[model samples]
Target: MTGSLETFLSTAEVHDAVFSLRPDYRAMLVVADGFDAGPSDAASEDALQAGEAAARAALRDRPVTEVPHVAAWREAYRAFGAKPQRTRNSLEAMMRRAEAGLPRINRLTDLYNAVSVLHQVPVGGEDLDRYRGAPRLVRATGEEPFDTVADGAAVVEHPEVGEVVWCDEAGVTCRRWNWRQATRTQLSEATTSALFILDALGPMSDEALDAATDDLTDRLTRLGPDVSVSSRLLAQ
Candidate 1:
């Protein structure tokens, strides 16, 4: 847990007070350099499809809710007045979309989206360059700004009070845990620096989380030449 990402998390005062991830909570942080988030290639597209197949297989006999670990995400969402059915966590959302097939975005995004569905974890990435000051997971006061694209226009919105969010001095970087990402820190084809977060809760073991991170690391490290990777487990 070092670099701009670590600095971002440590500089926030309200992080631990609001988001004391339970003793069984676990998050795998992957910070990388030399990332080329260029357009998706043939191989990347294939991998995404394969991951979608796996997701479909996982849901063939059971719904996402019965997945067990997803129950923790549902509880967390309800704590903030969000209905998990209406505002699905990243993993559930990806699983739904993956049932048919996943849309190929880019090499970086495609890889993570695939992994999220495959492992059923909430995985998200941020363009580290767009972050301002430090980032923290805190309960929103309902006044801090959040920049996002609404419809086809850029809009500034405020998060609901008690909503858990990832924020910095500028604005909210991610809202409702892993539900949405801000445009400010969006990864693009030209992005070279990136930070990825993997969330897991009770009923999910550390060994499973480690396996997911290892897979993610292996694929990302080969994203481009000279890519350097570092990872840490952020948990209780």
Candidate 2:
């Protein structure tokens, strides 16, 4: 696997640790890209509804609890074009809720939601074209710095130093303040090809991560014949 794949795989270890510490907690990772339509369009209402149904069925009798963070995520998106105060407040509120353990909900949100409900853990997805290369999954190291995207929206910077980050060649991509965008790259309807990373944190069983990765790969591959999918475990 390449260095990038390795980084994502390392998240499985983190998953394991988290499970060991909090056995009642579960986590999942889901990634999809290269659909006939981009994530924005490919993740249609029908798709999300179907995904949510699948997720509900999966968690029907599980001991798992959900921390839905997608709703807050969507709210952030809705606030994206609003005034600065409203935007910042909305995003910050969503961040706090996510930190407090809320499962996010979105059209594209259902994909991760299904996995999270089934696995009984947290799951997140971001548009790769919207991320900087080599994004890090770490916390803010210093004062929050940010850059504007081609859309003219600002991303909050607060990567915790020494913590794992989904960092790109440019800087942090999707984690914390910037849950789903990078200043350098942004997903658009015009996006035809892309990369995706499914990151997990804490001590998780290899079998589990593999299963998740396999399932994700299978579904995404069917989305397009030219779609390229790869997986790896990142070493801390």
Best by lDDT: 1
The residue-by-residue lDDT of candidate 1 on 60-170, one tens digit each, is: 899878877677888878877889999888988888888678878888898888888778789998887787765577888999899999899999999999888888789
lDDT (CA) per prediction: 0.80, 0.42
Candidate 2, residue 200: the lDDT equals: 40
TM-scores of the models, in the order given: 0.91, 0.51
lDDT per residue for candidate 2 within 187-211, as digits (tens), equals 4445443444443433345566667
Query: Which regions of candidate 1 fall more than 4 Å away from where they truly are?
Result: 1-14, 20-23
lDDT of 1 at 18: 51
Global local distance difference test of model 2:
0.42
| Per-residue lDDT of 52 in model 2 | 49
Worst lDDT 10-window in candidate 1: 1-10
- Runs with alpha carbons beyond 4 Å of true place in candidate 2: 1-35, 39-47, 54-123, 126-132, 147-164, 177-186, 201-204
Candidate number of the best TM-score:
1
